[model samples]
Target: MMTSRRDFLASAALLAAGLAVGPPLLAAPPKKYLGVQLYTVREAMEKDPAGTLARLASIGYNAVEGATYTGSQKFYGLTPSEFAALLKQNGLLMPSSHYRLGEEPTNGAPTLGTLLHGWDRAVDDAAAVGAKYMVCAYLAPAERGTLDHYKYVADQLNRAGERCQQAGLQLCYHNHDFEFVPQAGQRPFDLLLATDEKLVQLELDLYWATKAGQDPVALFRQHPGRFPLWHVKDMAKTPERAFTEVGNGVIDFKKIFAQAKQAGLHYFFVEQDTTPGSPFDSLTQSLAYIKKNLV
Candidate 1:
């Protein structure tokens, strides 16, 4: 089976070319899409909800997490139908929304007569907007301050989560630095996670988690697949804890993003609670950087 010189050289050249190009061809990287939390542009949203959404879409945001609906139902304003239409017109998808869990006493609890009247309406509106998640973005004063209080809050979250689940939506809790405070030897954040793995999930705010002196990677390691959403914001190097554009600050997003699979991340929204410049400019820059580097 000895080959001639010409045939042997040709076969060797073909084999070398295939080996050089095969690895890249076989390894197709995953696509990383970007989204925005509307709350980041609260001021602009207040002025014109539709216009603000349009601007966000134009800036390369394909998905949006609603802060409020500013239309007819006044379920913050935009009725589910109207809001859905608005998003459709602008080529955006509404995958999640922030809603205050358990109304304030002044606003009346779910047991109150006025509140009872609209339970179905709330569920209907959420469905209409195509929101898969309804996040409890904050806690009431009575709900915080101690370990016992957080445990109680966690129970309420479980109950609410059951309701959300019935409506084909998942319930999530968004964190701020306060949740990181330790109480009676256990972190409130840990207590919340321990509440009910099935009933409660986390939407980790990377900036706040870092600000609270906790490592985001450690939390991810401690509870794999518990975090479904992430607020990808950067923290300034200053002592005041200022909000900086994504790539301009000290947070290492690339490292955090690498754990997306273990964290069960479904969406990562860019949120700068207070941008050094205009919120729009800040988010635009953040998105550009994420696309260029983190993705």
Candidate 2:
């Protein structure tokens, strides 16, 4: 009935402390739901894309990045509509696709008319499958030799990105170790970043970036809000630097993820290029680690 001013002040102080710390103590970090690149399970997928997708869904994958359209589209085999229906039936979402840049038929190769023709079909199929990104997964061998070559690649990427913009999708470049090599006194990757930040966003493969002797965190700092996605795989302690599941290697994901907002991260996919055992086992272990440590 009678409360002293001193007691009220003490209670208020305690309340403030609890308000400041209680939520963090009780609540876990937000869940980073796991995604798998279909490429990791290429063997299984090649055998049965539909069946493999069903199994992946059952294994708790909510999203997928497409590696090929092997259903009925004749691009692979599946029509765009058929591919979309298959994914929908299996409770999966395709958010991105990896396409080769200069390998399309239209550039006067053997079979197809131009590389861009296949790319156009890819964009149409990706749109049909509701993908948000069209990714240039790798550069051609000819395109990889020089800085001038990379600049040309960047130019091509800008053009592709314009098409992607018209299709309401973003074009992204997935890095490998080669891009880190110095060219024209700068890393080709850096040139690409500078060439067109809007036209070519990044899907930084943490493992490859580290293998290339670059710091992922520094890149994030240098290009704040440019990376939209990340490949959250790990590297082994060996000289060959084999692929390992997430959190099993030395990369500090906790530190990298601390700048999630600055990195413009929308989603991160767990990709083990070569698994030591079953792909499912590797992915499950990786996802479990993320759930426990970095989520």
Candidate 3:
């Protein structure tokens, strides 16, 4: 088909202005979508969600995963659509969110229907913000006490996952080092793994697995495709083993990233829980390292 005069002139203007490369047939540019979990700059997000996202975009991050959504099912106090608009304005997208179940409801524990309804609403809001995954970010200490507890939660997660699937979303659990620790001679993580694989996917936090002395590669080998997301953080050399910016610590990220396909890594996010200086600077350093070595 012949191009119209207006289209041709527009194309010419874009090329002349250096705003676009050329016609799509000549070459198609790759889209770079580097991911960051917003919890890395929790303070900044709390202060100004919009500004923090703008800063992230300036740092070359195009994707974000939220780690905070509590009480009213809002993202940093803004409605889902409001937050989505802010993210769009800053050239960013949120693909995942950490929504907690919250301390297992004290007043005689809400009915299953009530829980699922809440999850449905959460899923709807998350979808409104263009998120694909609604992850159970953390489990409370009081909620987990024995093997039966893990089994029960697994069942709950399966039902929850079914509900999430109904809304065209995936449900997952993010783990910390505590899951590796034995409880009643069986690790809670193991119970989670034993759950219906299709129902409860895992989002592995690399630093915590390493800190707890578990090999991520081996886990991948054991359960391929179970882990689709990763929290890519590094552990410091301190005794407390605090989180540090990637590539400046003891973890072997290059080697781990080499096994990403084997580990079923669909998406990964840079998350440094303890940035000693400016979080933006730390994120920049981490992204630079990832671009040079891991990605």
Candidate 4:
């Protein structure tokens, strides 16, 4: 009933050849979701939010991080729910948004949606807009200038973070070169990092970090798992250190992105403070670079 000895030998040889050819090829890893910070195209959003969203989606961005949520109680003049609907219509997700700490005082009444003012309401709006992380976007000149100021900001961030956690959202601090500047022999960025990890996370901006002469990977090693969000932009090679499209400048994003796990990176947004031409054009270049090399 079985094969003859010669046939058995032939089958054995075929099996050995199959083994030599190696095991079945493994499936390629799932593509990571990449997003863009709406601030990259602020003007367009201000003019027409829905149209801007559609254009971004067409350019291959699956997600967007909001940069305007204050003053109007709306996102780009649309209520949180409306903005969320527009995003969904455009086949995009809003995973994170930017808010200010409100360290500086207003003229008459307190501003709403700031970490110092109406933070709980801000959290509600963030949730309504489908954001999982709310970032303290920037620090004004008056808000900084001293290490003590940073400690105060850290305390406020902790309180804000607690409220965010209650609402099922994470709080993060977005940094700039100013934080890296030494204040009385201490860096504010380091001071801010001392905040409770459970309460506050960091949104590291690669461009600003490089501008301040710090290595992004080194920071990741020092504060492993503290960063969950990132502003992905690049610095021009010239002395001006101008904003440039991703991969069109000097930052080694490939190296930085390789350390995403250590950085606790969940989402990153492409941002350019200013662009030479249309911002959408800049975003297109950055998205292409990220898809081709980094993601």
Candidate 5:
């Protein structure tokens, strides 16, 4: 998505008028594809996976990310192959899936062979659905209570990355605002980033990063290409700062989307943890805003 000088000039009118300068206008060639994390519509998906997916495709989503696959190694009760076919039928790709990787002590961690054939079929199933990246979605407060625990997690993630790579996938870590808090005057977030650079990629959540008072662009500058995915959620205007649809909130998405290349964005998924009404409706509103103003 290069912003050639000509395209930049063409978009100058919008910029001068202070209109939303979405990527489609400022950049050249093939418009960016957008995906939504299915968790945003978990209830609907849980009740009717097929119908939910069909609706998403119609709403202009070219891709999706799975948030859960916990029941019987099946994605929402469908086998990996079935899930892949469903995505294909909807004209979508599940390039990534959220999976919980144990940050256990390496000494007690699964052996390489165990990882391949053990009861923990996360990596295998994720691969089966054609996912190229497996992201650890959350770390319970108990799991990250201390620096040593985080270091142990880093070690485990490094080991897990090796296993994922063997399965033709990359392992990544997703974050919330909690990671930004300082521990003993040193941020554990830094320790995680300081881990095996090649082994650990980041799925940067823009809303959480901003809520934590950290600049998303600065993080990109600090660690180029380390972020391959993002959770493009927005915060409501209330003092509680609840989750809201993309353009409805106060986030400067247009500014941030402009830095996609430096952030090494392969794909980003719109994910609003809470919504005023139907998740599909929220998705529709977010998609419209993104297409016209952020891409």
Candidate 6:
């Protein structure tokens, strides 16, 4: 086809318009999805779960990790499906959840969502709730026995991991300072690491690890690609060594985040056990710092 003078002028005008706008915005690089652990606002969640989630969503958190699941088979008083719907309504996801070891009897029956009694059911519920990972949240005083018991815990975690894998989810163990404490001249955390890597992984709690005087980088180097989740909590610098906002604390996050690939990090959640002020305010501060300094 032959172009007329009018068509030529029109094409030139279009080119000029494009040039005036400057290059097309190379679609702003995808923003990293930051997450928060619900435990950070436990009291608020316990009182008003829905409101708490909305507040967190407003704070720019893209995901949330659950911190409670009782024998009642309810997450903050909502069933798995209901809770999942609530999360979606607020534009959030539950990538992971915390569960107990269930080593002891509560009311003469093992809790439903624990490793002891109803783990398969727990796994099923976790899947229902849109969770990709199930974590052994904490070990109570009685559950944390000698090194031999630690071996038992490892085996149990492997079994649970296998179950989770069958449901297309991963199982992880969330560590506290107790695991790093030397027991029988061997760190129980090391024993827990004995779990089959294919079945189980670690959700390294950066604050507790630092509080115990363990280097997060050293752990990453020691077990490369074995960690998938992280609790990005921070520790205070005072003598008491309390919990604090992420960047306000002494913990060196930039140094540890640099090793994220080695740590096999897929998701991380900010958490503060006991915030000094309003938890939401504290979270806002932490998220601001993270956005400014870290990822």
Write one digit per residue (lDDT tens) for candidate 3, span 5-24: 00000000011122346653
Alpha-carbon runs more than 4 Å astray in model 4: 1-31
Instruction: List residue ranges in candidate 2 displaced over 4 A.
Output: 1-33, 69-76, 103-115
Candidate scoring better on lDDT of 1 and 3: 3
lDDT of 5 by residue, 1-295 (tens): 0001000000101122233556433433453568888888887888999999999989988788887753346788898999999989888888887755433223565322122223247788888898888777776454677888788877877887887888888888888887889989988889889878778899888888899999999999999989888888888899999888888888898888788788888888888776788888999999888878875
**Model 2 Cα lDDT, one tens digit per residue, 14-64:** 121223544644444343445777777777876788888888878777777
Mark the regions of model 5 whose C-alpha exceeds 4 Å error after superposition.
Answer: 1-31, 103-120
**Model 4, TM vs. native:** 0.89
How would you encode candidate 1's per-residue C-alpha lDDT over 150-258 as one tens digit per residue? 7777877787777777888887888888788877778888888976767779888888889999888889998998988888888888888788889888999889888
What's the lDDT for candidate 6? 0.81
Off by over 4 Å in 6: 1-28
> How displaced is residue 38 in candidate 6, in Å?
0.7
Poorest 10 consecutive residues by lDDT, candidate 3: 1-10
Q: Each prediction's Cα lDDT score? A: 0.71, 0.70, 0.75, 0.81, 0.75, 0.81
Taking the candidates one at a time, how many backbone clashes does each contain? 6, 15, 0, 0, 1, 0
TM-score of 5: 0.84
TM-scores of the models, in the given order?
Answer: 0.83, 0.83, 0.85, 0.89, 0.84, 0.89
* Lowest-sum lDDT 10-residue window in model 1: 1-10
Q: Write the per-residue lDDT of candidate 4 for residues 1-295, one digit (tens) a residue.
A: 0001000000000111123356765554554667888877777888998999999989998888887776666888988888889989998888888887776666677667789888878999999888898888887777786788789988998999999999999998888887898877889998899999999999888888999999999999999999888888899999899989999899998999889888888888888877899988888988888878876
Whose TM-score is higher: candidate 1's or candidate 6's?
6
lDDT score for residue 19 of model 5:
35
- lDDT, candidate 1, at 150: 76
lDDT of 5: 0.75
Give per-residue CA lDDT, model 6, range 1-295, as digits (tens).
0001000000000112223376764443444768888877787998999999999999888888888885776888999999999999999888888887788677787667787778888899999999998888888778888899899999999999999999999998988888888966889999999899999999888888888899999999999998888888777889988888888779999999888888888888888777778989989998888878776
Model 4 alpha-carbon miss at residue 247, Å: 0.6
